[model samples]
Target: MSSISIVPTDPQRWPLHVNAGVHHWQYLDLAASTKQPQSVAEKYFLGLLTELPNLPVASNFQDASRNGFRFYQKLQLNDGHWGCAYGGPSFLLAGSVIAMYISETEIPAEWKIEIIQYLSNTVNKDGGWGLHFAGDTTVFATALYYIALRILGLEPTEPLVSKARARLLELGGATAVPQWGKVWLALLNLYSWSAVNPIPPEFWLLPDWVPFHPWRWWVQCRVVYLPVSYLYANKVTKPLNPLLQSLRQEIFTRPFEEIDFNRFRNTTAPTDLKKPLSPLLRAANVLLRFWENYIRPDWLA
Candidate 1:
């Protein structure tokens, strides 16, 4: 965070030259952290820091293959696992934060600072964030991100937090958030358990021949849903911490008592429902609800 001083011989060109070098180093550091090449860093920064140009042509297949191998080399982690960037769908951070909290993992202060900085730097011009960095403002997306900031210990009354919370409340608050949002809020004790759709892990025990067995879903969806169903079946919630107490006010449109829990089981934010629900999926939800209330056994619970 050191400041740079510029001495300009030609005032018109000075700002451009100084700004270029400043951003070059900034992205250079980011590239170093991820083991990306200087050229890749330049391309990223120019799109934000300047204009982006078309990519250079590869002379032959061998040259292209060599470049691909170098890129893969950069992604290799020291511990032998591969490191990757997961950038789409910003709501993933909320789940990650909640999982870490539930597992009693402490996030480093430096990471907290960078997380805040990243959010601040990327906020939309109207003073809210979106579902993805490139998406439009959304209730579920903005609310969850604001909640994450609060959990990281920002004051509710902080200007950025207040603006985001106000936007969320205006957009119909936690009740209007999607299914995933409800689950995260419930785990944090910000919303009631009844607000969420039933997710029973015992569903995992169903025979492979069962048409709706959990194994038949896409792998990413099934794996995360498995743990989530286990927690939901047990009604797992962290003991009410002070952050949870404040979130009760910060995230809701109405008093906690007035929210109609049953009304929102199928509720999803407009931004979240870009794809229409399939008839098959809707039928599955109906069956899951029936099982959750009447058929799930005590042994399973």
Candidate 2:
């Protein structure tokens, strides 16, 4: 008969515990190094439960308004701003990570460790990470995450990095990455500026009556476009660090120089492109090119 010892009598409190099974001795040592309070664990577990009884669904405008304000109050940020969780899109994290890195923000080591742990834990059982944790594998999501780990100082030679790189290359490399992926790589100077479609800041200078005023776009699209226009107009590329140099080989199917980037301007992983490029969007890209080449400087700069 085999004996099984319960490691942390309450597993919920020690959520960061990595080991499994009847490893009481090992966990005892782990607990000695990191003392977590039972009360703290209880608090964390309670916070995870969101099954509060709902207020009666209001039929009238006044009651609904009052409830809405209460909900808003609960969602306030520490900085006095409103807070909302952004999910559904996996590529948002890539943008966020790049922005944090470029701004010279130092993420706490514990956060970095946990992020890696989460990614490793959540990766598909078949050995590939996906766009969303449950979504299908995609060049855009995989490449962005691969570069993010490298940016965080993970070695390209490591087995995990190598495996992800091989998956990316098999999906047709950086050229097959989505628009958002291209923007991130171009910002890092890993891809050519020409491969990206123009995101002209001049659009901001347009009249309200203009057919394509950027302000008319959806809020998320416009907000993302704002920084993109700023960076693109300046052709902003970070200095080539050693990590980026290694990424060149890790992300591509062949030599970086051999890639026909122009051919890939409209190319994106099928899995990542939920909405196909519209004819209107293609025409807009053509007009944006003309504006970028000839009209943007006088109006924007």
Best by lDDT: 2
Candidate 1 lDDT tens digits, 31-129: 344564333323332233323343356799987887777655544433444433464577777666666776789865544655676677677766567
**166: Cα error in model 2, Å:** 1.8
Off by over 4 Å in 1: 1-64, 67-82, 276-287
User: What digit string (tens of lDDT, one per residue) describes model 2 on residues 1-301?
Assistant: 1011212133333332223321111213355535653333223332454344466799999999988876565544334554233433667666667777777798545445544655565555444567777888888878888887766667766566667777877777778787777888898888887989878887787899997799899997998899888988888898887777777877888887787787888887775678888999989899888867877556465
Top candidate (TM-score): 1
The 10-residue segment of model 1 with minimum total lDDT is 8-17
Estimate every model's Cα lDDT from 0 to 1.
0.68, 0.68
Error of 2 at 114 (Å): 1.3
TM for candidate 2 is: 0.72
